[model samples]
Target: MKLVSLITAFSLISGLVEAGNERKFTTIQPDLTEIRKAQATAQPYEFKEEYVPGKVFDRFYNIWLENTDYDKAAGEPHMKDLRKKGITLTNYWAVTHPSQPNYLASVAGDYFGLDHDEFVRMPANVTTLANLLDAKGISWGEYQEHSPYPGFQGFNFSNQETYANDYVRKHNPLVLMDVITSDETQLSKIKNFTDFEHDLEAKKLPQWSFITPNMTNDGHDSTIKVAGTWSKNFLEPLLKNDYFTEKTLVVLTFDENETYEEPNRVLAILLGDIPEDLKGTEDDTFYDHYSLISTVQENWDLPKLGRNDCGANVFKIIADKTGYENIKVDMDGVYNNKSVEGWFSDKHIPLPPPHCCE
Candidate 1:
């Protein structure tokens, strides 16, 4: 059968677990002796290579916060402090409701209409931003806070003691794409915070990365203030570290807004090597998750995913490098509060096919 027909057939079966949104395994139990042993014995993954100079920044990293409205995040003290140290993206919009789709969009260029947080393994042929990065010999990795082990395939993992939401697969961008997860070499790149510390100290960090905080720290189960303070504490010393901040562009952004009644605007900041005059400035460029992909592609002269990323705006900080013009979105009748029907949506539409042939 064809890929589309196979997907359609899987969709029709209620009990079968062929692919998209199926529970192959339950959540990981960190307290179990065997599980603890596995986690302890798992080797940490690292990616280090010669710096591939980009048009502007040499290193690109993004830290995603939880559901937060633009105004709420802007008013927070720590967020304001971070804003003063970087360029604030005032017109950044998330693609849809909930967090999973937006996270997936950051790497995949499209979400395949994912509307909720669930265990999903896209077909192997789907290409991602990582693929583009690899084509240029640019190393990449994912830092997942509180994940039980390196390249963990579980759907979710709670804080063993408090039983709070710790690390969820939904917030992980690279795990959603089978192209990366199915390959052991690529999968090993997803490591925990301990590995992050080791890599940071050893200077084995990759040029490109997506960092996801645990639920409480990201404000998914708490408040935006928690996320902001954690973000500030996490990034403050890195700014002073020469190795970490050298030609690095770090973005502190949210997955989506807390309110579904308003436009899906979220606060995003660009941090790294800002001049005295440009610091604390605001860029009202219309941007979304896909913009990050386009910005990276333009900076590194990489191939486009040929999805929403192809037309997304490049960041103004490096617009001079690409000479690409960005437009301010007229928000008169624009509303992205709701997600359009797609494969994972409640009433599924079959337009956006899984890129099994990419």
Candidate 2:
């Protein structure tokens, strides 16, 4: 009996030793020499030619409306007017389900795993398109309607009696990024819509500007008709102005769709100084939120963030002039996930509260 027990113990010890050796061999780290060699072999993309005057517009303005599906916007009267007057991008899609992630992805190359519209702050190290614009000495600003101050960091502001949403932090992506909020100078650039008018009057508008309407006007707490009417009224005067019309590109788009089950297709319009031949035409090229960042990079010959922006398609006009090539990607595979429920469950974070003002 003692001899049998000794032999069994020896067999068990040998098995354990073999398992340990297997793990050690499989988990070996790559050496510095191998890393250097891999980096050396990587090829960087080069543009065919330097940026030309007509390749990209010098000024860019983006207006992001709230949750409205493509159907609703297509049926709206004012939306049709804008479509008739400007170039329409019929194949544009939102990057994700919620509003915040789409907005973040528009400025930053990626959404950074944000699945909720909570008042969450991003790490300061995260780079944004504002950083890219700043690096090239281009001016940028965010004009949020009904915001209390230039750099207010609150979650939401509402009217006391009506309880209507005046401004919500989640709608403004610049406030969530620490890179902008940390610097006083940069923070001051994020001003209220009133300041936008003042800047326009003084001809002091930034080269790149993002505009967000209040909850009601943006169709979040109201109907598509309301949002369309407000946009038409606000844009008619600006489109007629010579200062705003010359060498300027204005993009009007939505944050996301109303239904998570449907494809995240949204209405997008391009106006203001578009090439004469392209006006009143439709472009069916596929585009996502990262395309906004990629378009800017192509316009100014700026460096990419090496994230999703690396794979995004450039705007059609810019592509025509610069001979830009888009990275091939499987769109259906990329946007398969619909709701944020799985992400919220995995992170153990509470779901976003319903909009009380709505």
* Cα-based lDDT for every prediction: 0.83, 0.74
Clashing pairs in 1: none
Tens digits of per-residue lDDT for model 2, 106-181: 8876665466676666667777899988887778888999866677667777764687887888899888788888
Question: Where does candidate 1 stray beyond 4 Å?
Answer: 1-34, 346-358
Clashes of 1: 0
Positional deviation of residue 99's Cα in model 2 after best superposition, in angstroms: 1.1
**For all candidates, what are the clash counts?**
0, 0
Q: Listing every candidate in turn, what is its Cα RMSD in Å to the true structure after a full C-alpha superposition?
A: 5.7, 16.9
Candidates' TM-scores? 0.88, 0.79
